[model samples]
Target: MSGVDLPGAIRLVRANNVRALDPAPAMFEGMLRGWEQQQRSRLLARKTINDRLSLVRRFAEFTGTYPWDWTPEDVEAYFATRLSRGEVVWSTVRGQQGDLEMFCAFIADRRYGWAKACLEEFGRAPVQVCHDWNTAQHVAEFEGRPGRRAFTYEELQTFFDAADDRVEQIRKKGRKGVLAAWRDSVLVKQFYAYGTRRRETSMLDLSDLRHNPRAPHYGRLGALQIRYGKASRGSPPKRRTVLTVPEVDWIVPVIQEWVEEVRCGFSPGRHPALWVSERCGRLGVRRLDEVFAAIREHADLPAELDLHCLRHTYITHLVEFGYPERFVQEQVGHAYASTTALYTWVSDEYRNRLIEDALQRRLERGGGGTLMPQ
Candidate 1:
């Protein structure tokens, strides 16, 4: 790497005579600010920067020592405490350690001059404390909760029935929130119909619905232009368009009814949001979770199944529906096919059908020979 200028306009460097009543704490805060600036210049998102900073602060508090005195032992102790409490999974531990590693790299870099400043004042300098030996290994692609899974076919139908039934139940009482109840019903339908993540579903605008030339019967509801797809680290939200599949095409009329009739009842004058809350123009991601939770409870579904399982349900159904895996990957906006595979948990019935089909094909090839054991 080319030599970087000393101090480099970061907030860490100061005059020799500059001092604070509490110099250690002051310098620690300055180092954090300088690290924040470095990450900002890389165009990382605000939440990403804040999360990394928060992790470093927690580590420091746990160790009761400034960055300059941190050691590999402190890293082990801190994470061991978290492990004892089951505070994080393996993937989360790895990410937190990576954050500490990056922070150490920032302060220790000669270009920033933080080490020089710390050495002159405290006679100590920060060194990278998180090493391969002490950090969590990234051996598994999926480390999510084992109980979490896609909804079963019966469970899927029951949940939808519950959401739909709630609307009429509200109307029967002649309640004021009937319009809102209707909105939630339509929202639930779109969730399974499209398989969007919560934030992506919440961020949808009326303009995101588009006309498909080949699927003209469905009109503007034929495709969904997902503008806020999930992104990888240090990147902006991704974008993809999900075409409506024939199996879930029944949602076409449900969405159309919401837009053309029930949505106008919300009296949202000029808001472009497709899912308009009764109190707000656009529904929020948190509200999406709350709505799903209420419906799942009402239906008495398994506690382990969550809003994201609607997405899992979509992926599994598509795989069973025999769409090409590439097509399924594109519809769900997964960058890799392996990621799409991780979301799928096909039902035993689907697996049995595959076995039956294979046996039938073999029997036909062998002219009905029944004694073949290869």
Candidate 2:
């Protein structure tokens, strides 16, 4: 279709097609327009639209029918196809399911009749898919396979140490290398320390950091105001989270050094984005995979760990350290306690140590410890 005729063509298609009642196309179109409008408003990055469109196209292709005609069976079959293609893991399927559900809802709202029918037939297809997907993820987690590996604390530490060594090597290579090296290190450290989602971290601007005016020794913390996060319904519905002291201490210096020494005399205006790229101008989630890969190469670490694992590790560490469940939930910005709990895996050694320590402490407190009467 010609660019000028596209809208007219879409209108004609909508008018003639019974499936147009499905609302999926209209809703999808609206989303496309909304994304464009958002880009015009500079409220969203263009890449966001690109990414959403890519997923929307994939969903459309997978559904094999218009939105109005979509059935729960289609969703099931789509996932089945993915599994047969060796994409059986719940995480991947779950992510695609979320995208599809969003698209479905978008369409359903506009085409009430189709929406009602689909909803009645599917009996809340999205919710069911999400529930099943999560269950599958848990099953996969418990039944870990060879390719899916969880990192031990030692492995994590080794990776960090190797990353540090690489940073030193980069510094020796001079100005640009030094700045880039430091930035990567800071990014990696911040990922682990804050347990931040990749998008959240990428969205960070320089102003996101709060400096303590009262104390001279106080450093900048990666504190995000509620205004700048992924929120439901286009509003910041969740509370803001503060990065740990370690994250603050670790990242601030590197950032300051980069700003003062390397980014010297350069300002990107009021933008507080901490991460930028050579070409993309701003960093986003897609770029994180490359960053992780680079870090893996430098550290000689296995490629299993992704950016999300930092957040997972942070949650696991918090649980291991005796932090209250609620506290970890708040720190990680989890909407639900159960979501936070998924990341925590209690090791047998730690469990035994906790029991032993508790017994010893009880004995000291005159509770008779292990010899206590039943």
Candidate 3:
């Protein structure tokens, strides 16, 4: 079959056909193209597919051979090179191995015809070099650094106060950055208030706001529609509605002030983004990190406690505020209760309250008396 008609590894009409040049590199290029089509067929995100293709190319370049000629030694050599150089963190090794494994699996599959094609061209079929013994095991759950942690309530308050103070100080001095400072302050609150990731917060738009029927008091700020929640492999961005709990209900006025007053000053015009920039466009994720870092430094917070820690803090605070595990999961767009549970590192005060409440319940059940003998 012609490459145009065929999908995945079997296509030959392109450079893969090798009418003039040496067949090896041409065939390798074809293999990548086929794998790309195969991944696209599964509806994987473009960036995800691109990253995988790049991984396979890097592996091929390192080995100085195409997939058909790869061996287990090549895989070991590749892993060893990266590990020795300290180029990536330990968790990153597992991800790189997974990408390579997926690519080998794609080419080795008989249905894709890569194996048969390679055999006819080079007298050998492509084989999966990544195996159980060679690959890193995923034993750890949380791979984040030890220093990246949820802010204590006091620390969080200080950070918020610092951001708010920046806005006020700018306004008092009549500085040009007053609007930017005010926007940053509101943006930081939005991060903690909604428990949103940087990209999700960056993607927020004015139209994403809606009133929750159960909480009319919060009005249009009762819930936020997260259109770009992190996607699963081969899936589009997940969408969820995070309702404003009473713990973060203060955000109602904050959101109102931004939308009703501040955001418009950016001259957003037809732009619908909730966070507009000086250029009258939606804010980017990098800008969010820069803004958070600036405020965090001013507040003297831990340098390791980055923007994502705000998410951890939000989840922890929500759990402390007596929201059920499942409710917190939904609010944070976690697919599993366990995932949400991982984000929760309840404060000592909350844990102590739990102990007291448990003992009270036990007393109520046991004739309202202490069990200890006098």
* Clash pairs detected, candidate 1: none
Q: Can you tell me which runs of candidate 2 are displaced by over 4 Å?
A: 1-77, 91-151, 171-176, 211-217, 222-227, 233-239, 246-255, 265-271, 347-352, 366-374
Q: Candidate 2: minimum summed lDDT over ten consecutive residues — where?
A: 1-10
TM-score of each: 0.94, 0.66, 0.91
lDDT for model 1: 0.89
Candidate 3, residues 176-213, lDDT tens digits: the string is 98889999999999999999999999999888998999
Candidates 2 and 3 compared by TM-score, better number: 3
Residue-wise C-alpha lDDT for candidate 1, range 131-242, written one tens digit per residue: 9999888888887878889988899999999998998999999888888888998898899999999999999999999989999999999999999999776688999999
Error of 3 at 265 (Å): 1.0
**Model 3 alpha-carbon drift over 4 Å, by segment:** 1-6, 12-18, 172-174, 360-374
RMSD of each candidate relative to the true structure: 2.1, 7.9, 2.9
214 Cα displacement, candidate 2 (Å): 10
Candidates' C-alpha lDDT:
0.89, 0.60, 0.87
Best by lDDT: 1
| Superposition error at 264 for model 2 (Å) | 2.8
